[model samples]
Target: MTGRLWPRGLRARLLLTFVLVTVLGAAAAAWSSAGSASTALVTSTERRLTESIAGQIGAITPQLTYPPDQDALDRLRAAVGPDTLVTYRNLRSANGADTGLVTAALRAAVRTRKRLVAQRITAGGRPWLLVGIPIVITGPDGARTPSGIEVYAVRDLTGVDRQIDGLAWSAAGTAALALPPAVLLALLAARSVLRPVRELRDTARRLAAGDLAARSPPQGADELAELTVTINEMAESVQTSMATMRRLQADARRFAADVSHELRTPLSTLTAVVEVLATATAGMEADARESAQLAITETHRLVRLVEDLMEVSRFDAGTARLRREEVDVAGAVRDCLRARGWLDRVDLAAPEEVLLRLDRRRLDVIVANLVGNALRHGGPPVRVAVSASPEQVRIEVTDGGPGLPGDVVPRVFDRFYKADAARVRTPGSGLGLAIALENARLHGGDLTAGNARGGGARFVLRLPRNLEGA
Candidate 1:
């Protein structure tokens, strides 16, 4: 039952759901952010590589002259760094020669008076960026003349790749740094959502346990607070209704006690007169004598009913007292069975010397009621058994009858709850089991009834064996 309450509850479900969603969302966000940052950093690195290559190629372009000048070519080659390449095409001979790394297409573009950027071209079994520049000389008429092209350069981007790797590591570090806070926030959010739901569950459990006044206090300005307020209102309504019911119950008990007390004296005098007439009716006609006997029996039943009601009222008013002492439970059960002349009719079993701290009179009442119930409604040959453990005493009454009806078993200990009609032939007040339950509770114990596995009804009473020790 406890497992069902927590695992099936809304608070636990919602907390789990929120935590899962937050963790997934945080992970997704981190992945997306890392991807975007990596892409932006890589693109920027590539752009810088392009710009650096272009700048170096442009700086050496103006220093080149036309008409196969070896001095200009040598100067260009010497001015360029080892990572840069210079290449020229001998258009007159349809031949290409170059210094450093240069592709055929770059040499061809220089010869054809076009500039080109050849990226990631293979050179000496390695990768390089080949930039081609065209040298244009102007005639006196401002016409363009193309001679040999010069100044092609290549820049190594190995350092750029290393910087990109560092940037990527940094981005990963940033993402890692963000996780702890996200986890903390997720935990807090889950707690905020679950706390009120937990309170509601606890309040609901207390209400089930008969504390109708239990309620949740509103906290924070959120939907959860509103839910708390709503639950509080519901608890208030329940508390009010329960208070009204208890007030009505108290009034009814008082009325029953007052009316019973008022009628007891008159009923006792009438009972005496009826008894005297019952003696004289022995000589009268058979029908008249039977009627008189029925009247006496009914009067006795009425007296017993009034007395039971008074006792119930006393318990209700908190005026019932127990003369507590250490006594043998087996002796009490035996005495009850012997006094009621039920020792021969029913099977009475007891442990030899099961001692308990209890009121002997109340114990007798408890045993008598359970035994009488078994004998009356529980077919015949009922069994009363007593057993004791280190902590508690257990008394069980089993009947071989049809057992209690399923629908009526739960309310059997309620006052005025008769399995049959109240005006029927049964010689018992329905308050017997109710009084027995009350007495058991007053002794800090409980009495419970259920169907036995072997097709009968069983009433089990449990009481603390040593109240003082407890």
Candidate 2:
């Protein structure tokens, strides 16, 4: 819940944190000042009251008789003020009003020590201060003794409390005043911090989107600036590496295209020579005939490899064009199987007449490659099924094999990738599935390979029904 409520942006969180800290600091200072001032005011008031009461009693004591009577007590109370209590030998001041303000503790302390003692307390929901002073007699020898005369005074502290409360409110006001400035400072700080971050973010996004030229400008000699510099250096390295890779790839493709183009004429002459040799093999001796057949077979394999490379070069150079036609998909698959002499070897489960507009030659090539791959690499009982939807047509080919290896599935359609590296010689030039996938994608469709549920390798080809503008 706290995570949900907390600010997600750096600037907002920074501002909130700054304001809270400022307000809390101001409040703490205000509270301390108020408490200290309140203590000083109360202490000063208590001291002054004690001194005044003592002075008044001392000035009037000489005029009263020793072992003073009611008249002396009444005179003492009148001189002290209306809130004073003067008592001697159980004769209390008749006119005093706040006698209850003095606690028994204060009275006992004053009587035992023969000195002034004061206490601050609350009465009638208001603050009050009580002072108890014991009068003493001095002999001719300058020795003092208790005189059994005590004076008590009560002073209201309501005014002091009001002053303390004002101080507290003033402190709170100061804390409140600190907010706007704190927020303003926070905004300035956030701008300074987040500017470089925003630039870095934009630059990183551009780099991810393939704009290798993107770079962030360093702002100041801080951690963020250092990070910006590092990122710029990394981008420079990546740009250099990508440039080198692209040059190498272009050169490699050009070399393959050149080789394939150069070999086509000689390969044509060789094919003609092999055809003549095939006709002459029946008349030659058994050993010579077998050697001639092996030579012919290798020459044909070489020719196929060169042809496949040429086709791949065309794809790489973006010269492969699609010729779309409205054709029955089932009939095309059947024709592909029949032409390749695989009609009896595979099971077909296609509808009689599911039609789509697509490149007929490309579809033929795709089906031929898939079925041939299954026959060459997988177990027997190959299955081919054709289906159609409103948007696309699907051709699924499966073989009763152990299924594609987990590591091989990902790279099955990768150009020239083979599962068994040690078994280098195979009938395929290794470009069959790759070329098939390219053709499928050229029609705005896709091909996928995986393991089938019934335990075999499965290849599914999906081509869009409409090839208009594709």
Candidate 3:
């Protein structure tokens, strides 16, 4: 889902959204500003044109008489420009020409001696502004007459349409010039915000991959900094807790080792006394002899258990030292199987000489535990495989019995954790798989347990070829 991809992280998605919105808002503002400026320019240009034409007529009125000569009027209109046309009602008769685009209203204005102006009117099917002013005529007594000639001028405004086009092009040019910088700034801002989010994402992935010390770098005095600080603190807390647990686990392993060492001397003395009692058991009753033999066997099992526990404890305490040597992996498996009387039970599939640097005692412990577990609870005829790659050696032990209980599979290497508790109520200690795992780890290797496909358990051991500081 999109929600899964985005998450609730503040820095991830907001940066992109911010950039897009800012770009859109800037474009809108530029468009609106261009439109408003164009409107204002058009209105102001029209007003200026109106004032200029009115001023020109007012300034020329004193020099011109009513029913002025058409030649002088034509000269005045020619001075204005080709786009400007001037006409008068009485002058039209004097010139013997009809006034262009002039109506009867202009004649009335001439008779009343007044001015008339019309804006944005149609002339020759095109828009124009028409202005008319009455000219006063002086009589022999120098008195003004009630009736006067009307002079009108019509100016074409097609140039206004051209000016509007020019204004629109200018606005578009300005907006175009501004857009590149806006896009660049938006990209930079987006990257700045997304950087922190990318770092956080990588850190989260590292943490999930079991690197508990992963943390994000704090940036500024803002909400992002606060979040970074919080994530770093959480990582620190997790690291501290894991360290404490490892230390406690080491202490517990040391305690077990100490107890095993203390029991060694007494157990050796008990074994010697049991050996002496076995000689007299031949003259005793059958049940008494059987009981004595059972005690001795249990004592022997206890001795092996204590020794394995001590080795495991040594590994946990970081006190286990490896005696590394070049040895044939196949030979080791064969020897282990022979010692456990399981040579017939296991099918060895290996080369004649697959050499590896390993500690012999630790390797023996790993092999023995796997074989013993297969023999005891993994049914008959187990399969033992040994192979070697260029960098490591692999040992596999498989059985045909029912696989380990599903719930107990993950914790099989945990100390004292046992499945089928009711079936394993004897005096034997539950430290075989744990010791095997510890020994494998001590040798720079690993032991893994899983269900075999043919309805059984399978244990695999992988060890590095070069066991220098194992």
Write the number of the candidate with greater TM-score, choosing between 1 and 2: 2
What digit string (tens of lDDT, one per residue) describes model 2 on residues 247-336?
A: 999999999999999999999999999999999999999999999999899999999999899989999999998888888999999999
Q: How are the candidates ranked when ordered by lDDT, highest leading?
A: 2, 1, 3
Query: Once superposed on the true structure, which residue ranges of model 2 sit more than 4 Å away at CA?
Result: 45-115, 120-128, 148-154, 277-294, 405-407, 453-455
Write the residue-wise lDDT of candidate 1 on 316-376 in tens digits: 8899988889898998899899998998988878988888888899999999999998887
Ten-residue segment with the worst summed lDDT in candidate 3? 90-99
Tens-digit lDDT string for candidate 3 (1-470): 98776647554355546555665676567667767876786577667766676677567766765456787677656544444545554454312122365667655654554554544566666656555655455578999653444456566666766766776676667656666776677668767877887888898889889899899989987887888888889889988998999898778877888899999999999989888987888898999999999988888888887887787777666788878888888998899888868788788898899888887777887888788888888886688888888888999899888888889889988877778767776444688888888878878899999988888899999998777766
Q: By TM-score, how accurate is candidate 3?
A: 0.61
Instruction: Give the C-alpha lDDT of model 3.
Output: 0.74
Clashing pairs in 2: none
Q: What is the Cα-based TM-score of model 2? A: 0.84
